[model samples]
Target: MASGKYLSILALTGLITTASFAQKSDADYGWVLDSSKRSVKNMPQQNEFLNNQYPYPSKPRSMWELGVSGGGSFIFSDIDPKFGFGGGLSLRKSLGHIFSVRGSYNGSINKGADYRLRNTYDGINGPWNGNYLIYGNKYVANYRTKVHQLSVDFIASLNTPSIYRGNPKTNIYLLAGYSILGADVDVDAVGSNGQPYNYTGINFEGKRSDIKSALKDKWDGEYESNGSIRNESRDAIGRSDKNWLIRHGLDLGAGIAFRVTDRVNIGIEQKFTMPFDDNLDAVKIGSANDFISATQFRLNFNIGNSSKNVLPLWWLNPNNYVYNEVNTPKHMKIPTPVLPDADGDGVTDQFDMEPNTPAGAAVDSHGTSRDTDGDGVPDYKDKEPLTARDCFPVDADGVGKCPEPPCCTELREKMMAKPACAITSLPSVQFKTGSLSLSATAKAVLNSVAQQMNANPECKVKLTGYYKGSDKRSMQLGWDRVNTVIKYLVEQQGIGEGRLIFSLSDGGDPNTVDLMGTTEEGPNSIPAPFPNLQKSK
Candidate 1:
């Protein structure tokens, strides 16, 4: 009855605990779902080094396990089959994820009787039947015994990368071991009051209802030997000497375990042990060897050094070691570093780019200054940095030499008319919405603009960027477009930076308009309506 109640509690507890764990969403335990997706590229080189030397690189340390279990034990012998209370304690250590070793001690007490032999002896009037009276009549042939066992087993786990790459909620294992067993046996007989000895009907072969009744009641008789029955002070084989009988045995078992928490687990195991000795019950009449079988429910606890990240060796995958060691070997060395200069401009060796430079000076990224146009004057003193190759000979101010007119008289007149030349608005350059990249058609148009600007060096152009949305992001995007256009003109066309101005329009066609004129009144050199639109840090 007690064993039945224990099974009931175990079933109910497992159901409730499993259901609670099932209710948790994947997001609640992100590590479990993400561990499988980890890649070699993201893992450190040290892990690869460690994996070559160890079975599981991620788990370098593990904890020992201590467990206690209780259940029913039964022995198959000459006597009738019956169950008795049994319990055990064990200590385990893992050698690897799939293999471990354990040492344990288990003890049990049980009773059994042969009704046919007892009935025959009771009916005999005088002579005793040798079959049932191998021992003196003072000791009945029916038996009861207490057994103590010590064993060491090698346990193997089957689950691997599929169900548990690391830690698992459930697992199963098989075990095989050698054991030493000691037994104390006694016999059941009729009492002085003329009643049959301590029979609780527990070992009787009967219907299910009769068995149920037997489990609920205690036996009325006691285990005795010739010495105890005859009221003599002599010692019997197993009754007086606790270590009188000892046997060597082999045990095989299988078990399933469930992790209830990081430090706790619940398991069920069944084992069958076969001993070489035939006198476990103090009777040598049976043809079959004596064997003991136990089915138990165990509660295990992780002892010293328990941590959530630690898992039983059986929960790890040894394949990880081979995979990492072969693929990401650490023999390769890291490369040396190189110097960096973020901006292309010369000068300012630090990583900063100076904006809105004064009139005329050419610089490269290395802080070196020079005049790109070799017009005999330094760029800092030159009025025009991009002096035409055809007009190389220049004055002190570095202005290119103008060609003499065919008619010397028209030279002064043409010079005066040059400043009076009227400048027309350049065709507007359009851009696609949300894009700063230049299209083939846009590039073609900008080529013409570059030519016009080169021809009219005195004239400056205003680049007005516009976008359709009023949000800050949209405004910043417009600002980026304006800057992109300016960068292309300065770098590709060799246009002087001083000749261009940038401005932003909050809401308009999503395009930039380039207006060429000498006047700076309309959007030229005007501050952007929005603050610097660079992204916030």
Candidate 2:
């Protein structure tokens, strides 16, 4: 029995060790990442990693456990006490992290003999030369008994939540339940071969050294009580009637388990069972019933639904939830922020080169105020971006003076010799109502006029401005448009002012027109055709 028990323990140890290694290997490759390889700010939250794809209390399903245990069982009774061997098998199911249930079948076999009665019993006193026949024979009887029990227990976990970290390593629990026991007891006289058993060369000091060899040859040279005498005692205690011998009992147990993996655990347990009868050993002399106790080593293997994600609820620590919740931020519904643009430019502050550019300024793609001619002046402040290089020392408007060329004498002689020619009409330059600013279409028209003037360099062009109103503001606005066109020509196209003439009509066309020709034949100042149309102020 000891050898068999040792082998069973070795087998269970080997299985648990193998499973533990596999569990460790899986954990090494799981979701845990190395902190050295990434910054905390960039790493996923620990709780998020642990609770991935599953929420608390609704985690993946787990398996049940099938277990076997073997160890020593002893009966507390009026008869001489003896050590016995007990073994059991159980099926356990966990309801949650804190509770579970198990059903089990256990059996124990025990043998007991009375050395004092065997030495004193005589034929006159029930076959041992004693005076009291019935009691003496009863005391001398040796008995072998077998007990089978079935029980169901509700178990409560005590330390699972505290022990389970990423992987559970241990669990401790308490259990209590109901049990039913069936027992059979057989007894006979000490000597079956017509001779009293000899105790010579035998050690009766709680040792079984040669006892296995002695009991090997059947019942020869062994102490035994008369079968009839033992049967009478059994019948008195109702053990002979199977229908009256079954017993109900209560059992309480406690155990501690060391987890080998998610799928295996090794445990040690002690359970006490009390039957409601005193005939377990066929001896009814005692006032109290017998107490049966077993202390065993348990090997439990989880079975069915072998998902790695499925762990026993007792193996899950509630601290995991607390850790995740405390460490993770709650998601809030809020509007996205608008990017800052301090200068009100189209470019945001982060990419803007001139974050504080003045309002109404024409800015470039970089948010810097425009400097079209690279003249060191912003378009907002520079009246003439195309100022000539020789005109550097000028006013704040960036207008540069045009120096006269040294060929004045020859140009005067050529002009005096040239004859008059017919002028050609040019397209009108339109303007917005009461405004002097040039539109893109007006600038394009001015470009064409500049090309024509360049082709006919000897010609002087006449520009005539008109407006619907004779008011001073209207007159001033028309004059400003004419001057703006002249400035554009001189600064942008390098056209000389002497080659241009200007006039105004009160209400002729409400637009500026140009004609190019020689001195006398070119368009002179034109009179207004609708004099009455002008606003009189």
Candidate 3:
């Protein structure tokens, strides 16, 4: 019983040792970095290196894990033969993309109470020799009794992809290691005889009582033939002497690991150990004590999913990145041209000004648009390209191309006669300095003018255009200034072109300053002082 208890303690110790090694190995390599070989100095730096040429995360890191399991054992010995059952625990650590190491401890206690023993002695058959003495008696002895044994083991296993527990979903592994074995046994008799005997005694009081009792009970008076002194002396050998022994042995196991999640794995393993020393059984016939072997089936759980990425030893070698069929190194250099059409736009760098146009779109000479005004944008994109006649042909000036003196003079007289008909009173159709866009204040006034135009369809007006310019661009600038106002009246206000008129001049006419001409900013500069349309009139 004492020896069996010690074996259980040793098994528990082995389990702790296994967990210790796993934790140590995990701590040693968990945050390990190989900065000595990683560098940015030799590779393309800053603007010289293209963005895609740089490396990013190759793979996400895997975590570490632990597991445990249990099962039974079959004990064989001459003193007792029985089946005992037990359980154990294990720990494992993953080393990057290649390798992993594991340790585990397991043991069992068998109380082999219902056991049997068989003994058969080959009769010493030979021609009677001078030295050989022949006796005419037959002897047979067997012991049926209770025994206890404990087995403990420590194991280390290697995992591989090509082997077991290597593939992603599930893997298998082979394990081998050493263990300590211990046991305790109580016996009934010694030698090939039915009588109980003891090997030695202290000669103290009450020591020979077991032998005296055995002789009086099961011996049936045959004990006197073997002699009372032999019984008394041999009875000392099997009685009350403490004998506990320990031995180390080899252990082997096989298991399958399955990933339950990204960070955890569950495994089932079966293992057995063969003790090198025979003290494990302690009660065998003759001089040999039979060793012990335990078989256990366990459910193992790994914490960090180490088995998911069991790495190969030579993974860091650049040559390992080779392709077999192509017979070429995957990382070997091959010239790759820098593509010009990065955005996949049809436009090339040289000819296409807007080379990076959207992938599927029509472009102009400058890769912009065919229609600068974009009244309908263009025929390619305009759903209502021909919806409005004003979109097709635009009259630069609101006045008709042919202006007869009688008709023009008549219209001008009527415009000046109205009290609210002055150019300023038509709401401020202001223009930007050196631009045709109307300002916020100008837009407000223009909106009012549009409202008035919508109310009075019969009203007619002439927009006399002028520019504060003293250069070759004076006429062009003045024309654009007048054109802007005319477009607003006709296009925006829905005023008929025939109802509006425009006065175009190369520059502000000095002699006709008292006429209906208006002053504005210079073509290439800002206006000095605002021109008063009243004074000009």
Provide the TM-score for each candidate, comma-separated. Answer: 0.51, 0.45, 0.33
Residue-level lDDT tens digits of model 3 in 421-464: 22223323545455656554454344444544443444455565
Ranking by TM-score: 1, 2, 3
Measured on C-alpha atoms, candidate 1 has an lDDT of 0.60
Give candidate 1's root-mean-square deviation (CA, Å). 12.0
- The candidate maximizing TM-score is 1
Candidate 2, residue 306: Cα displacement in angstroms equals 2.8
Q: Any runs in candidate 2 off by more than 4 Å, and if so which? A: 1-56, 115-138, 163-166, 194-244, 328-537
Off by over 4 Å in 1: 1-62, 76-81, 113-142, 160-165, 192-219, 226-237, 240-243, 259-264, 276-287, 304-312, 315-537
Q: Tell me the tens digit of each residue's lDDT in model 1 across 1-537.
A: 434654775586557546533432111122222333234453443365334432322334456789999988877776665568799999988877778999999998866654432332343221123323433342234567788999999998765433213345565778999999877766544454534434433555676556535532433346544211111132244564443456799999887787787678888887888986555554555467778878888999877544323455555554544444355744334467554434333223253244333323333232333454678775567676556678778889888876756677575555434453234445566777667787644654565566556656777778877766657767777777777777778898898778787777766665665545564534324444466665332
Error of 2 at 304 (Å): 1.4
lDDT of each: 0.60, 0.60, 0.39
Task: Estimate candidate 2's alpha-carbon lDDT, on a 0 to 1 scale.
Answer: 0.60
